[model samples]
Each structure stands twice: as C-alpha cells, then as structure tokens.
Target: MTATQFRCLLACLPDPLTARVVRLQRYVLVSLDCTGCQEVGVLLKLALLSARAGDLPAAETVLHLAERTLRALAGHDHTFAPPRITRLHRPRPRPARSAAAPSPGPALAGQVARWTGTRPLVAATDASWKRGHGGMGFLTTDGRWGIGDWKVGPQDPTGPSKIIITELRAVQLLLSTVEARVEMTVLIDSLPALSYLWRWQSGDVSALPPGYEAPHLRLLARRVADRPRLRFQHVKGHSGHLLNEAADSLAAIARRRAPGFDVEARASDLVDSFLTSWNQQISA
Candidate 1:
C-alpha cells in the first residue's frame, strides 16, 4: 500500500496500538533506502504519535531524524527549514475551586502575623538549563540569595523540559529560605512555574503537568497553601528588570558549576545601584 493509504489505515486503529505500529514502521522505513520528503513525513508523524503516547524521548529522536532528512534535501541552499515543536505534552485541565470556600480564621491570621513579623519581603527567581543539567537561583531585596543545581539522571522524572522543573525548583529554594508566615511577594520569570503555584493555591491537585511526578511538588504545594501571606507575581525575563537579571546571572553561573559567592559582600555594590535606580523609576 502507498504511504498515505498506510497512514489512513493506521489512524483507524486505537491510539495506543497505532502508536506502537507507527514506531515499528518507523524502524522499517529508516532501514530502507528512503531519503526523500516521504521519509520525513513518516518520521514527523511518528514523532507526533510518540508525543501523544507520552514518550517524549522517542518523539525527540524521531524529530531529529526528520530534521536530518530535511537538511540532506536542502543541501547548501538552506531553503527547507524544519518546523519547531515547542510543547510535546499538554497538561490536563484542572477543576476550579468552589467560590464559597471559607476564608482563614482570625486566629490563623494572628498566628501568621506573629510568626512573620510586620516587615514585608520581595524576591526574584530564575532558572537555567544546559545539556541534561539545570540551575536554580533566587535573590531577595534584603540581600539574601542562593543558587543550586539539578542533574537529570536516567531514573529522574523530568516532565517535559528540564527548564520547567528547574523553574519550580528555584521557587522551592526561595520559599525554603524564608519563614512561611512572612508576608512576601516572589517574582518569577516563567509563566508555567507561576501557573503551577496559582493552581496549587486554588487547591488543584494536578498542579504539576502530565508526565511530571516529582515528590517535591507535593511538599511545595503544601508549603504554598500554608503560607497565606506569600504571593507570587510574574516578571518578564531579560527586560531590564534588575532583580530578575541578577537572579538569571546567578542561575547561569550555577548551571556552569561555578563556585558560589557571597551575594551580600560581592553583589552589594551592584545591588545598591540597581535598587536606587529602581526606586527612582517607581517614584517618578
């Protein structure tokens, strides 16, 4: 049968079975002397199917093959550019919380106030991903900052991208350094990481997207839920935001496995200058 006819038949099968059949057929096609657009089409189809089946590594491998084929066809002309696929796994929609839920009691509020004190704190967090490793960084306006790294291993559950995991880790590390009762606002550059926190705040169990089952997520969710005074806001990355830029720099340094430095002692000069400029901009 022709390639189109074979694909049509494959579509008629169940999703799980179809993915298996397509993966098997991909191997057969690769073994043959097929080096044209037809092969690229088949490889792309297999990649999509693998993604749907929650096999991201298989999908990435297939996409690499498809790109290789396209490059071979384009030669030195550089006319045929491969399509970019950003997200392979889409998360299941979370159910909204009831609007009539009870608010925190006055006793709880008093306890939080006593624990956190009256002063408020603000911080920014950022993350970096390279190869199979990731870095997380956070810096507070009070000169308290930290940097850490995560190495994705074979047994680790790394969801869709290491960057997303690292972003959440940055927030987690930030929260760990501060008191839970402290009135604080954290700025995060990653929308997905902020969304996960928002969903967790709303009592959504599926805050972590599909294919992500990290144990730390549950603890993070619980910590966020307990801290009613803690807030999160989105900050645009690489937009001349001083605190965000500092956090990003720290994450990059951590990703390179560089030695840690004292932010208070080393970054005091730059931080003071940025804070002055930022305050002036806000006042104007």
Candidate 2:
C-alpha cells in the first residue's frame, strides 16, 4: 500500500493505539520495501498494539520475530527505532530570571513548617555532574528505578551547565515512571530543586531560576501540577537513606557511562556569582 493509504488506515484506529503503531509501521513501510507484504505488515501492527497496551516485553519479542521475517522476505538489512515511553508536556509557563529565589513568602515558610509526610511509594532522586554532561536517577522504595544523563550538544555551545537541571530532570523522570493521579512522595537532596518546586507549586513564577534551564524547569513544574496529590520531600544525602543512596549510586554509574568532552569550566563560576549576588540582595 502507498504511504497515504497506510496513514489512512492508522487514522481509523484510536489515538493512543494508533500512535505506537504508527511509529513502527511508518519506519517499516517508508524506510523498507514492505509494500503489499501482508505478513510483515500484520506482525508490525501486532507489535504496535501490544506495546501500546503495556505489554512491552511481548511486543519487543514479536518485533524481533517480525524483523527476522522481513529480512527473510526482503533479503536485506532492515531496522526501525524502538518505541519510546511518552512523558507529559503541557501547560507551559512563562520563564523567570535565572536562579532567582522567590521573595520571602508564607508559602516558603509553610513548606519549612509542614514538610513531614511519607507515602508508600517513595522515590529518592539524585544527580551527579561532570564538566559537560550529567547523570540523574531515582529509586523507589519498592525497587523501581529510572536513570539517565544529559549533556550540552556540541552544536549548542551556549547551553547552561548548572547541576540543578540534572536534579530537576531526575524528579521529572521519577514522576513519569509512576502512575498518574496516585499520591507519591519524592525525596530529593537538592535545596534549589526543592525550593523551585515549592515556589512553582505556590504559583510564584517570578521566583524561579534564571538561565537556559528556566523553561525546562517550568515544563517539569507542569508535570507536577497535574498530580495534585504529589508531594516533594527534602532528604539529606549520604545520611544512609538506602533508597537515596541507591539513586546516588545509579546516578554515578550513569555519569561514568556518559560521553566525555571538554567542559567549559567558566559556567560554574558565572552561576556562583549569580547565586552570591542574589543571596546578598535577598539578605539586604
């Protein structure tokens, strides 16, 4: 079938179901010679449906079979990008100044007074920074884990290198791994990350960090906003919280696995200056 015909077929399916299927089928049909090949087409669709329904392991197994089947029929190398888990991105908020601490308010005071609660689903998150790239991870009380790393793109030399971005990303990954609408407590050791979340939760956007990471922080806040019952808890690192220690270990591993490059050392100095000035101004 033509690409248009295949698209029309996918359009008839439900959105969530069609999205995953489209990822698999678009690559197979457009990149490979799969026109009029009913067997391979059926296998691709089955894999897509299974993955969309949360049977990811089964879908991967079937996809391997389909890959072999396609190679047997087409007699050439064929490949498709594996499906990626979707994260929520919505309700984008306006960016504020870089590393700007919110003016002293009752919300901040209240958070300090009322920061004692725990849930069964506990996620302890941490980040490790190198010169250019950084790694972050979150480990739950129940053994679920999410780990990842980010680095400045060689093409984007102006990117910020603050470690708080990695910390925020770890919280975002932890929240994404858990079910939505379920109450969960996230323990993070970064004071800046915790402060940012408290400010965002209080709807005080003016009191957000400044820099290239401001918009990304706003994005992370939007995800937290969706889960009204979610809570952020500050925990001291290296104080022997096993889950936090595990997350720290995972983050270190990810940092080791991250690609090494020449890090621009001046970024940290600049950020420190900003923080120092901001703190002085707040104190005055």
Instruction: Please provide TM-scores, in order, for all candidate models, with all chains considered together.
Output: 0.53, 0.51
Error of 2 at 75 (Å): 17
- How does each model score on lDDT? 0.60, 0.55
**Most lDDT-accurate candidate:** 1
- Point out where model 1 deviates above 4 Å: 1-119, 259-273, 276-284
lDDT of 1 by residue, 1-284 (tens): 23533453353344565555554443323222334645666776666545433344676687678667656864421223332222321222445545553111000000111212323577888998877767777767665666666777788876775677789878876775666676888999999888888988887745676687756666677778777887899999999988789778767655654223433244344445555565567669
Candidate 2 segments exceeding 4 Å error: 1-119, 155-161, 205-207, 213-215, 258-284
Measured with C-alpha atoms, the lDDT of residue 12 in candidate 1 is 30
Model 2: lDDT of residue 244:
64
TM-score of 2: 0.51
